[model samples]
Structure formats: structure tokens, C-alpha cells
Target: MGVDLRRWWFDRQRLRGDLLWGVAGIVLVLAATLGGTLALTALFPGLAPVGEVGADPSPTVAADAASGLAVNLLLGWFFGFAIAAFQEETLFRGFLQNLLQERYGRLVAIVGQAGVFALAHFGYYPVSAWPLLLVVFLVGIVTGWLVDRRGTLLPAGIAHGFVG
Candidate 1:
């Protein structure tokens, strides 16, 4: 399975034109998400209060940041690009969402996956951070829609990486 997966992954025909569109889609979606977040934060500042129980950065995260700029960038690239974008998107969007869509239709699959994606972060965020959950859900929807539009997971993965 691993060998087959690698072969398919590196197949030039399968990957043609994905890089350009994927990067472009990611940039567009990221800009929209950031703009929306800023607007929401401005309108409802209470939703994003700083130094609150769930708002403070974790010690482990702070330590990672303190590990110096190069280390931080490397770690970010590894996790954001390799893990979150490629692996997670392949699993969630490529396999799970695609399977669900075949059985249940597009809307159900998108919303269902988004719900799962939002819930998957429950351990990392407190219930008080509902705003973040909402954003994550919205991002999931955007990524899922991108997958459907592009007829491939590359664009979705790119957008997901940017969101991460």
C-alpha cells in the first residue's frame, strides 16, 4: 500500500496544474478567512479577549517558539505543510469526505466533516473558545468546497495548510 501510494502521489499526470491552482486558492481563502476574523473580532471584541483562560499560549507552545527562529520555521513547515495540509487533508477530505459525499451528497459530507474537524480540536481548546471553533468550521467548509470545485485534494490541502 505504501509503495502504491508513493507511486500514485508522484505520478506527474495526476499532479499536473495542481501546484499553481492550489497555491492560488490557498492565498485567496487565507485572505478571506483573515479578513473575516478581523472583522468579527472588531465587531465582537469580547469573542477574542486576550489573556483569558483559554486565550493564553500554552507553555509547550511558548517553549517551541523560544527554540529560535529557524527551529520555529522548520517546525511550522513540518507540521503545517507536511502534517496538517498533506496528511490530514488526504485523510479527512480525500478519503472521509469523498466517501461520505458518494454516499450522502455534497452538503452532508461537507458539514459532517466540518463538524468532525471542529470537534477534533476540542482537546486543544476550551469550550470558552467557541469563536475559534466557529472559524475552524468555516475553514473546513471552505476547504471542502475547494475540493469539490477543483475535483482534487491538492487545492484543499493547500488552503488547509494556510489556515493552519
Candidate 2:
């Protein structure tokens, strides 16, 4: 949540207290992925494999994200961080990472996990599918880079939460 975004977003957030910078990173990455994919694959090419399916956003997922944020924020210093920080950082940043890195080289492992994060977008909408996956994949790379540079997961999770 605290580092490595393009200067436009970062500079403004810096004035506000570095929180928005977290958000900026996510936005920037998503934009990058979408821009890149649209440039290379066109908009509808991935529709068959991913877009032609799915409709509703799961109530369970919505509930989890909402309740998760509520619980974590209220219980701050513990659960707030545990939910907002720990779950994403350890699970997305560490667990999925371990599995991926073991089976593939570090860069590929990171890219694969990013793809999985992107794939989760299928739960949203068909037309939104490719862009969502592309965004998340890019996000994964930035987060992994943050983790590597900071040697901590909390910051990355902060960015993820704010972006969502």
C-alpha cells in the first residue's frame, strides 16, 4: 500500500499520507495490464474461454470481503491486520507463491500466481473477464516485487485492500 506506483498517483497520495499510494499502485497496474492486453489480443479474443460464462457476484464472497474488512478494522492491531494484511499477504503473497515458485522458476511462478488472481475475476462478469484477469496478474507482479524489496507482506496487503 505504501510504495512503487507511477509518480502521478504517488505524488498526490504523498500529500494525503501515503495511503492512496497503495491504491494508485493497483490502479496503475490494472491499467497497464488492460492496455497491454487490448493492444495485443484485442478486446473480445478471450471471450470464449472466459467471458461466455458466469453472471452473479457470489453473496458469500461479498459477505466475506465486507465482514472481513469490518472485523479487521474494528479489531485493528490484531484481526484488522490479520484479515486485511495477513490473509492476503500470507495466502496470496506466500502460500500461492510457494506452490508456484516450486513448480516453476521464480518469475514464471510469480506470473502464474498473478494469472490466478486475475482468473478470480470470472466471478464478476463475462465482458469484464479478460481485463480483470489481466489486471490482477499485473498486480501480482507488483506485489511480489514489493514483498521482495520490503521483506514484508503487510504493505502489499494494504495496497490490495485499498485497490479493491
- Give lDDT per model, in order: 0.71, 0.58
Model 2 lDDT per residue over 33-101, tens place:
557566546656754434346565445676589988887666664553446455655766666765677
- Clashes in candidate 2: how many? 2
Q: Kindly give the number of clashing pairs for every candidate.
A: 0, 2
Please list all clashing residue pairs in model 2, or write none if there are none: 72-80, 118-133
Query: Would you list the clashing residue pairs of candidate 1?
Result: none
lDDT of 1 by residue, 28-129 (tens): 678756776787787777774435764465456655566776786778866887888887777777777877998999999898888888778666656665
Model 2 misplaced stretches (Cα beyond 4 Å): 1-86, 127-129
- TM-score of each prediction: 0.74, 0.49
Off by over 4 Å in 1: 1-11, 49-67
Find the 10 residues in a row with the least total lDDT in model 1: 1-10
